[model samples]
Target: MTAPTLTETLPARETARSWWGDAWLVMTRELTPTLRDPFSVVFGLVQPLVFLGLFGPLLAGSVGATVPGGDVWAWFVPGILVMTTLFGTSTTGANLLFEMQTGAHERLLVTPLARSAQLVGRAGKEMAPVVAQSLLVVLVMLPFGFAPHPLGVLAGLVLLAVFGVGVGSLSYALAIAVRQQDWMFWAVQQTLLFPLLILSGMLLPLETGPRWMQVAADANPLRYVVDAERALFAGDLASATVAWGAVAAALTAALGLVVGVRTLSRSTR
Candidate 1:
């Protein structure tokens, strides 16, 4: 009897297309769960508003008149947007952990879905809500006299979305690697969420902070995000701040995607 021939694998192009399709399906399914949770959506929408309204006025007098082109509340608005995105994205990992515990992740792995597609889809689904939250922050900021250059505002929003997806992916990966839903939930808040917020220049300018803190902020991608937002609001599109911010956001996304997939694969195995 003749030896059996081995089957040839699909080309990379075809593989990528297949993965993309699977990702889309998963993304759609994931969205349904979020949509059904009206309380989640409502809370996500309201919290940012509360933060902006409460804090904006409180600090306006102190930082508003002191900083260059201050309008402290306006400057703080972008930070709130970033904060909203970060919180919204970070919590997504908890759901992923739940799925893993419930055997949903195992089912997904046994299917023909590409690992990357599954990871991207999960992160993307979380991103949609973040984008909505960020936009609502912008609207809330408008009446407070925060005006971004129209085109720059659009660019900043796009960057924020990309950044959120990346950070969220990273958080999901951490959650998976830990494999404890409650622990992941707390860790996301303690490890990733709070550090990024405090170091990111959200509440205050980096220049005004202590030397070591400023250095740390400089190294933080979140700082760049706030810088980009600040530049957009000032109508200074060509500034180095926005350019660096975009670069940092892109790098974070790329690195996070890689780490997330690896973590998910190992966990599944």
Candidate 2:
């Protein structure tokens, strides 16, 4: 039997197709070019990979001694993953800004796809590349003695995507909201980027910081994500860090997409 049409599956009062399918369409549309471009993958990961190679080992012994597992690479991987997502996804909306200026976004807005689908799909497409970044980082670290369990490695990749989706959605929403304001983008991007990394203990342990700094880091969502990643990378699936990170991911994704959908809708109007 043939699959039911989207309209048939919905109540008679509803006319729109399935948001899931629309999302898939959008995701596939964006992901196709990425898949075809080998260099884009390398370009996206160069900074993180460089940090992993050049700067990471200087403190590897010290950081490893500080961590419970005594594995500096494992401790550091989580922060790098979060950093990877933050630095990578922060610019996703720049393309949208260009599209808006050129009236491309207005055209896309008029299409029959659901607004949620469009936003979700773009975020979804980003997942593949983000996962690829994780793999690349891990492989590069392997020769340096980082050996996370295979299942934990898989879990870490999933969390990286979750974190990426939240950040990417916010990037697109902000880009749409601040259309053509190049300075605002740079200002906010620079301000948000390093603070998140520094405050979250991606470079050092939050616990080792001053009392005020540790307290402040506790409030940063990315800290939870990095902590979760550290746990997962260390083969500790039952860690509370994992739960908190997932919660932050869920909340971030929900907030970002809601605002993004609304912004996309207003832009179209």
Candidate 3:
């Protein structure tokens, strides 16, 4: 028995599905592998968990005073969630790269699905893993004396999903841009990822840093999101921090989606 081709799996033109329905189909196809191999999700989690275990304790001991409520878990855990979003969503393009190599991307391009749906569907899948990792991190920290407000944490997850969608879309755009030379994808990703992480203060507070560093952080959108996550996780939902974070997340999502869709459309043309 032979495997079904991309067109065989996609909805037929006679089906008359909306753009969202088409996107759903692409998302389900993209997610099928991750669903079948649960270990991949766990494996993807190792780095964030390790950072939580190792760097978290050191952060608490060293600069616990700088953290809100002087509770490091409250501050650190949300940052880890953002970190999970960053690392997890940023590398999603690698899978697209593999698809390109295998001619799977080309096959999908020739299908009747909307081009934007391909990018939207692919980026949408990023939310699930980040949600799982965020919940797991919260659960793991609870035993260690970490507690978050229920409603606030739920809101934080919504923000995280919005942010993840944007970052994931940008990553896919990068993948399409560098499809001709595979190594370039990794090169650009690594070069930009750490700077953004450090500037965003995911592992540590940046308040005591030099004025220049603080100014740089102020410009980084990720910083606002992290601040919002901290406030939300700490159950302070009605803060200026949360408002700024929501704005940043919304902007990033908008930009990432536009770039991703345009790139995919141009590449296929």
Candidate 4:
């Protein structure tokens, strides 16, 4: 047979490419703006740093006693990392909203890129900023007694990335759903954010809360994430908490991607 034409070969080549490769390509494209304005990444760390400094000391006695090894920093730092992950990823949809408003999303749709790759890439892009901020939080707290288990911290980052992907994907889906009504996006985001944060016990332990509050925390997936982070940072990799956290993160990532990919497909079509 004659050699396939370039146009004929291109579709095959793209189809042969792995999903992750497509996702990586999309992630790199999404990261270009962040690279140009590196300051934004640094700015994102400010809130977590403030929480680390201000709230950490306050948890010394009460919360400290509850933590493993009696080190409050060990407990607080991981929660801060989770907090950073949650906040950073949860708002990523606004970027998509901006793109939608400018017709950039439309331009992207006309490209050969798979729509799922677009969602995965945008969601995966949040990992870099969250990881940078996490490392900074670790270093900043290191001298102050936040001793991390090297392997555990690495695993924790993996878990955090998974969770971030889920949160970011959901945000993008939400943006697509409310594309015509911008105020609804903000309203729903804010409405859900604080409840999740508080219920997750990132800033404080939920054990001391009343029965109803404790019951609510049990249902919050974030609570498991925070617990896993704390356990992982303390070098408890094999603990049931970490396993449950992994399950929770995996489920969230799966759900978000399913919902996001579906929403994106429906919208574009």
Candidate 5:
């Protein structure tokens, strides 16, 4: 005739144990608000599509000349796809800052959730919009003759998801570091993201950039990503391009997650 105490029924430290489960919990928490507002998701797609639509065709002829036998849409779609992930993941830190300021993060800290899982879950969930944008980009571009091979498209999505995790984690780390300073968060994100995009050879051919720019691009990890994406988009999978790109993306994700976890844990402490 014994009754279980509240503590026995609900162990605070045992609330979340599995890393993947904790991550999934965090992801769902982040996803609900965004899902409720469908417009926000759709709204984010407009600018990228606009670029794909207006920018793709307009620069196709000029950029196509750079490739040996360029199909205008072929040359441009991959870069646009990369840009979609970039734009989508660049704001990862902002919303976290909102949660921090609202003391939502403090509530999370009291839970048994792993600190890294917080970032992993949030960043991992961002794949939704990124993949959606990828699909939309392909669907929209398909009509205009952007004929990406099936496997290539699948590989490209993987590339984007990997890259998005990296970028999103970086944003979270930066955001946590600057949680009290909203202005600095925005400034740093905008400052770093656009420059990285430009240097990645997304909008133009890397070979054609100025000497210094080409040198800079050579060192940029994103260059590998774009190159891989471009090759995949063109259905050329039998090359080192995808391998190199995967390595770069994996490196970026690893570094970002490590940094993000450490930063968030320290901030909580």
Candidate 6:
């Protein structure tokens, strides 16, 4: 029998770095479609600006700087950042659903890439836009006097990214499980958006709500992200609650990644 070719004979080292490299390639390729699409690229930047410009002033009085150590805009800034990340991350599932429906995903599966790599790549691509949105929120907040400690701001940004990754991975799984794109959109909006928005300290401070809401907020991962952002922007170092929140958010993302990889594996089969 002929010996295997050199390319085929070499051991496939599926290390973390290799997986990350594959994911980076996938992310780069995936980003082209998003960048080329004018609406998506524009909306990603514009939506948050509109929200901040319109709602920031309108709600400023109602959520005035009297409630706690932080000002109204400081609290609002973090929530807006979360909202921006959500919009960017949640829509990623639709792109995956489109690819799955069009057989693009199948084409990718024929390669030597591991299923986890594919999932991570797709997820990493989705996170790119969220990162952009988070940055934009920080820029917008700077003018409004929302300034967190340097380290705190960095931690908050990291947490936001982690939260988005977890949420996006979960949404991607749901998108694949469903048959149609519209249903995926609806489900994400209804199930993921409202709960995270309401329960998290996004629209309002968790302390301002009822006892049950406070408990629910404590359990919500997004709450930690919002808190981290709020604490950072408000320069409330002593009150910073993001260390535990970051740990929780990272754990959640890791779990979501595992679940997403399993789901993708099964679906491809």
lDDT tens per residue, model 1, 32-145: 977888567667867778877777777776676775576676578778888888877877777877877788878888988888888888877866787667776677667757
Best candidate according to lDDT: 3
Give the per-residue lDDT of model 5 (tens digit) for 29-93: 88898889877777887888788767776776566677534676776788888887887787878
Worst 10-residue lDDT window for candidate 3 reads 7-16
lDDT string, candidate 3, 18-106, tens digits: 99988998899888998999788888778888988899888878998888678888889899989899999999989999999999999
Q: Model 2 over residues 52-78: C-alpha lDDT tens digits?
A: 776678767566577656777777876
Candidate 6 on 110-190: residue-level lDDT in tens? 887777888888777766677666775677668778765677666667777887787778777777778454575666557
Higher lDDT: candidate 1 or 3?
3
Pairing residues by index, what is the TM-score of model 2? 0.90
For residue 269, what is the lDDT in candidate 2?
34
Q: Is candidate 2 or candidate 4 better by TM-score?
A: 4
188 Cα displacement, candidate 6 (Å): 4.8
Ranking by lDDT: 3, 4, 5, 2, 1, 6
**Candidate 4 C-alpha RMSD relative to the actual structure:** 2.6
The whole-model lDDT of each prediction reads 0.78, 0.82, 0.90, 0.88, 0.84, 0.73
lDDT of 1: 0.78
Candidate maximizing TM-score: 3
lDDT of 4 at 19: 73
TM-score of 1: 0.87
* Residue 235 displacement in candidate 6 (angstroms): 3.7
Better of 3 and 6 by lDDT: 3
- Model 2 residue 225 distance off true place after TM-score fit, in angstroms: 0.4
